[model samples]
Target: MSTIKLLVTGSTPVTVTTQKVLVARLGDEQSSHLLTFVAGGRSIIVKQTAVRTGTVVVVVSGSPGLIDAELRKAVAKAMVIRSTGR
Candidate 1:
């Protein structure tokens, strides 16, 4: 299990800790991945898409946060374990 500490900035900045996270590639899209986690009694979903131009775009929905860039980084740092015997 991987733990991520998120620093959410808003009117009052606060830090949120999340341990349960899932990272997976969507279908056969090599440049896209899905990240899901629970925080503040709500589900957070982050879709990361990487382009061939060396640019990455992240779209976050659910449980809105002020620090979107940081949230994206935390989601990207999550450990994804895949079973080869599937």
Candidate 2:
């Protein structure tokens, strides 16, 4: 299993940052939202239960090599953009 933390920065609230990432990446988010997504041909679980003032932590858990470079970069970019409001 692997864990990745997405840090939220800039003026945008952490709440908004989380929402943006969910909407952008996790399109099929249910009310429970603990959905499994396929990345690098592997099923990955995305969880964002922790919402802090300056950080939006999105933990991706699954087998080894959880997420690829592209997806990680995309999520990080989303968080950064949401934070900076740019």
Candidate 3:
């Protein structure tokens, strides 16, 4: 799996541990995937598109540390979903 190294574009280092959550919704009419994170005590959601067959969506919700680790986990879960032809 690849890593997401977000670099700062401005001066002065800004350190923040963002929490992320993965969600997968499948219904008879439509399917959707989402990645939600927390910043400043607020919840941020990142919707995923272009999902193909056998794609898995995982949800990681918790503190920054937990979310950080779950990011990798989400990818791994996705791979598994693909393998299972879900």
Clashes of 1: 0
- Show model 2 residue runs off by greater than 4 Å: 1-67
Model 3 ranges with Cα > 4 A deviation: 1-55
lDDT of 3 by residue, 20-60 (tens): 23333331122234445443456455443322334344443
lDDT of 3 at 40: 40
Candidate 1 Cα errors over 4 Å, as ranges: 10-30, 53-86
Model 2, residue 77: C-alpha shift (Å): 0.2
TM-score of each: 0.30, 0.24, 0.29
Best-performing candidate as measured by TM-score: 1
Error of 2 at 22 (Å): 17
CA lDDT, every model vs. true structure: 0.40, 0.38, 0.43
Instruction: Give the clashing pairs for model 2.
Output: none
TM-score of 2: 0.24
